[model samples]
Target chain A: MSEGPGAKVYVFDAYGTLFDVHSAVARHRETIGPSADRLSELWRTKQLEYSWVRSLAGRYRDFWSLTEDALDFAAAKIGGIAPEARATLLDAYRALDAYPEIREVLGELKAQGASIAILSNGSPAMLDAGVSAAGIGDLLDDVLSVDELEVFKTDPRTYALVTRRFGVTAEDVSFQSSNRWDIAGAKAFGFRCAWINRAGAPDEYAELTPDRTLCDLRGLLDASE
Target chain B: MSEGPGAKVYVFDAYGTLFDVHSAVARHRETIGPSADRLSELWRTKQLEYSWVRSLAGRYRDFWSLTEDALDFAAAKIGGIAPEARATLLDAYRALDAYPEIREVLGELKAQGASIAILSNGSPAMLDAGVSAAGIGDLLDDVLSVDELEVFKTDPRTYALVTRRFGVTAEDVSFQSSNRWDIAGAKAFGFRCAWINRAGAPDEYAELTPDRTLCDLRGLLDASE
Candidate 1:
């Protein structure tokens, strides 16, 4: 309830929250015609693998590089990745389509005059590409990364960065992520977290239950005030 | 390798590392009935979910309780879990077979005069049951848990505990797991990690590459020297 206009800040999780990322892989199913869903699953799994690996190796790269690396690796599986398709894959990332309600939700949150920022595992470049592609860059105060934390999402330190960056108690911030684990991470770190279970991921962990569950960002925004 | 004789510890990851865990659900495939390994997949997915959720909610139970919760949840999916079957489902855990080489490899590791231990995400009871059931309890010097770490395996602290307890740097310890991400995590935290890729997880993560890959623990011990 303290999250009204005067609330310290409202931290938003990117990836699953503001973006239709599952559609990225699902799109490959439609676009590739042969590999279809296989490509999508490979891309998603490899993408997560890259981010996690890069974080562990102390080799910080923008998420753009990681995604391309993942796509290339996955492409190597069914058949060799065509040089052309790799470029298309990168383009697909920057051109990621926002969920139907994301733009409206961002606009509404902005109109409310609340401080809004993004806490994402995506590298700055990737975040830039996603927001630019979605046309919601102006709505974000800034995009943050676990790169700063030297780890990936679901690390409490990654969540700590949000409140520490804002100089407020975790209660002063409301974190949102479509990934249940990320939501668990934020809640475990004591943030008032909202889980946007767009895919209806079954409950996995305990204690860090989402203070609120929403079908999408618009649902989050609707329920926030 | 700063770990002296007393300092060096071989921390075995439980689920896929030492114990043939899928057999737990694989045994239930008749009741859950194999949609071609659906039960194993569901059990694993739920176990992970329960672990993360319990950690978040601060309702900390040992991994055994969570395992039962996950089994019941997954069992409910294909059909109702009967009380008798629930007992059987859990009994499967206490009597899981070891990976073919686990017995030989663990015996070799211990015979080589290395301090051995289990670092697992399981509740204390589950870890105990798995180790005793696998018939390798005597081979392990100690068992570690997120119960003490207050975080799950992927957290750096989870790895940190073993190093600190054994008084070794992450550089000296050789951590192993069947889970690709857990290996990725140990490597991320700067531990020497081996992927016991029983299910054949590919090296898709370009950054978090394993220092070594082996078909089984025997290969791990063979490669160690």
Candidate 2:
């Protein structure tokens, strides 16, 4: 029941942590058929894989293009998707459904005199559309994208953006990411990290451990206290 | 019927290219139950994922440890693996089976006076054991490990090691890998790349296409022509 470690800035990972990435596929479940979930999972997997591979290769492509490329791969694996349906899926991605508690949590965080922002691999335009559609744009003070540095998450430079933008040391920032790899990168970079483990997935990155593991953003409010 | 692109040196990726990465799990199929193949697939996926993430985060762990970490993840996901069984799997990995055509193809390439080597994300010890077990050490001009650079493949630096070691330009090297991403990296780095598409999985990284796509190493012989 004690108060958690206080951080000067709370930076949340945009996709999966705030907006539900799978919602785009869910919206067109009928069109995708029984393999919809499988398609969505593959799409998400390839998106991250492409990001990491591209980052390591120093081939910087915007996340939007990467998202389309991932969708193409997933669609191919799951069977051909109609061009119209694929377009619909991509459009749906532009305004993905935010998690149920996103608005309430961001409102609470803002009311608590804490600085909040998003640090994401999403391109600026994608993040802008999603944040505005999710109606949390007013709650967040800044939305940082990797497109600025032409790299993706898990890169030290990507994590450095949060510290650089907010003008705070990594120790003064609490980084929250639903992606364990992102958590590992941020934690390794010296941020007080919280892993938003919504799926109860198994642990990874044996050497670097997150500062806290939370099931949802509600747990973040406690950290601010 | 026609000679393919000739290069000064022929470089290959180690795991999945020369050796069978899943052969280790095949050795312990009964212990793993029906999920043996699943476990192996997940293990390979996580192994590569860990490598990419670690490389991006600038946190380098030897491929051997990462291999173990990946196995642990796959085992935990599929269910608890007995400690002794786990150790057995790890031992099996140290000397994975070389692909049936590895010897013949490497011999042919070397016979034609091509300088052939391995440029891999594997640690020195892992590559050493696998090459010795496969009995292809004499056929190789050198075996390069990312351990020296402390970064995994897809990083241009990993590919650069080949050019540096052989004292050849990237254009003077022919890099082959069963991994599409590795091929993409090699191609982007200016190597005459060949994708050993053993699985015939969907193409990715749309812009950076390999110079050739071959089903096996036998096709590599044609390139040496």
| Best model per TM-score | 2
Judged by whole-model lDDT over C-alpha atoms, candidate 2 comes out at: 0.89
Considering only N, C-alpha and C atoms within 3 Å, which residue pairs clash in candidate 2? Answer: none
Which CAPRI level is candidate 1? incorrect
The model with the greatest DockQ is: 2
- Per-residue lDDT tens digits of candidate 2, residues A100-138? 998888788778767889999999999999998999888
lDDT of candidate 1 over B1-225, digit per residue (tens): 344655446778988778777786677767755552655666776676555444433445677776776776566655555678778868888778777777788777788778788898876877777777778877887888778766565657778878777777788788888887788778878888788887664465556778888887777666654
- TM-scores of the candidates are 0.79, 0.95
Give candidate 2 regions above 4 Å deviation: A1-7, A223-225, B1-7, B223-225
Off by over 4 Å in 1: A1-10, A31-35, A45-62, A69-83, A160-169, A220-224, B1-11, B34-36, B45-61, B65-87, B108-116, B144-146, B154-176, B185-194, B204-211, B220-224
Give the per-prediction TM-score of chain B. Answer: 0.88, 0.95
